[model samples]
Target: MHVAEEQKPAKKSSKVKWIILLLVLLLLAGGGAGAYWWFFLRQPPAQAEQAATEADKNATKGAGKTDTAKSEGRLTTLPPFLVNLADPAGRRYLKLSMDVEVNAPAAVKEIEGQTAKVRDAIILLLSGKSYTELAAPEGKLLLKNEVADRLNQILGAPRVTRVYFTEFVIQ
Candidate 1:
């Protein structure tokens, strides 16, 4: 009977220990989630406002996109551009076809109205890059971003959301 009583106490103590361990684990998980929310999920106020503005633009009519895509934006295809790379050793060229995503119909009209200036800017930008500068995937992304940034500046707003290199060939 004494041995039985002692065993009961031991079992109760072990259960308490187990409950404590489970609580600690739960606390750790909750803290991790909180940190993730703070660090990764939260956006700066300026960026949040920008995103909200873009969403408003997307919801407007005459965005030139299907239902699903119009919820985000629209794409406008640029004429294919072929430029000789700044290769000194030999002749190297890049033929690139691209599309730009615009925020709204006003942006599209602005882009269309400045097609000549846009093309000239792109041609100058592309013709300055050598084959080595554009051979890698990262290089292409940088080029796309630069074009978007430049176009946005010329258009006097953040109208261009993204640039797509639909076709890229180097020789």
Candidate 2:
């Protein structure tokens, strides 16, 4: 029958549309999963653990071998800094704890020797920032770079290559 033929084509078209829609949805889900893995899970847990172990060994062993530390990198932890932000309300404060990555172990000793000066410089810089200035990700990154530059200046060498904020809190 003519009507039956028309109904069959309509049913086929409807099924095709559903199949296409399902495929599109599957593609979108796959893309989202891929992006999540790329951003958050790119580093495997085993690799991170191994790197941490290596860092510990380097820290302990390179304390006496500046050449080894210089060849690679050394992480030096700094005492946490708690400073009042230069906000209009004067009610905000930031508590930050970080590790400085230096090119040499001598830089670590230099930082330890100049702890007072280093703390002073960092405190001043941190206190000069307003709450809004350090609230965004870009602002935090800028602060990290600025802190590295300041540390290098204090050390009188371009030793401080990176600053990793282990704990950052602004309130």
Candidate 3:
């Protein structure tokens, strides 16, 4: 009986030692993962601050360049002209009128010399669209960009800055 009781205490002590060892291993693993996240997985705070500073510097530089370019007279406004489109449904045709601006002198001269061709292109583009399309802001902006792009291609330069709709009416 005495020997059996001694054996039971030894078995219980071994089980308790194993439980403690398992707890220690779990704690070590969790601490290692936390240390890795802090040191390597995450970016440093100073780097994030440096990136923000660089972005601000770039924004300021861009603003300065734009201001200087505008002061140097890189902008020019073109005279408004009304263009007529052929209407297959009736005798009367649609008319579109808008003012355009071109930044390059060479492009301006090219556009002036090829007024008939430019007008024809504009008329064709405008005539193909319905009144509802022209009425929307996004559609009008798209049309302006398309006109600028086509005119620039004909002029052979990226000179057109904007196309303004001074007058727009469907009849």
Candidate 4:
């Protein structure tokens, strides 16, 4: 009878130890899941918001610069010129009509004030060109740059940004 009584208590102790271990494991798993959620998943959203704010600030600065450029006046046209050819035949010529766009109001006023000088300079430049030189794309670009430079020199500033060809004919 005494042996049986001791064996019964030993079995009850083993069962209690197993139940305690299972409860401890469950608690540890739940804690680890909670830590992962707090540290990794929840932190990136704030960082993303900061990045968005910085992008908006840069966009606003760019918009301001564009607005300032718009407030300045513009020039739409310059007088046309007829350029004779430099070839040995000397029979071909080009008629060039271009428009100049200026960004500065004072520079536009300056160009308007000295129209005769500008016209003379353009005539001199065009009279020296040839038909073959004026027909190519590279030649056209070079001519535009030269015209813009001459206009800027007369205006005394880097006011002209582009020169557009309204008419170009070779004969």
Using lDDT, give the best candidate's number. Answer: 2
Q: After superposition, how far is residue 134 of candidate 4 from its true place, in Å?
A: 1.3
lDDT of each: 0.90, 0.92, 0.72, 0.81
| Backbone collision tally, model 3 | 0
Model 3: worst 10 consecutive residues (lDDT sum): 67-76
Off by over 4 Å in 1: 1-71
Query: Over 4 Å off in model 3, which ranges?
Result: 1-94
Per-residue lDDT of candidate 4, residues 42-126 (tens digit): 7587887987876766697778844333633476677777767676788887787888888876777778789999988887877
Q: Rank by lDDT, descending? A: 2, 1, 4, 3
Which candidate number maximizes TM-score?
2
What TM-score would every model get versus the actual structure?
A: 0.59, 0.65, 0.49, 0.57
TM-score, prediction 4: 0.57
Question: What lDDT would candidate 3 get against the real structure?
Answer: 0.72
lDDT for residue 144 in candidate 3, whole number 0-100:
86
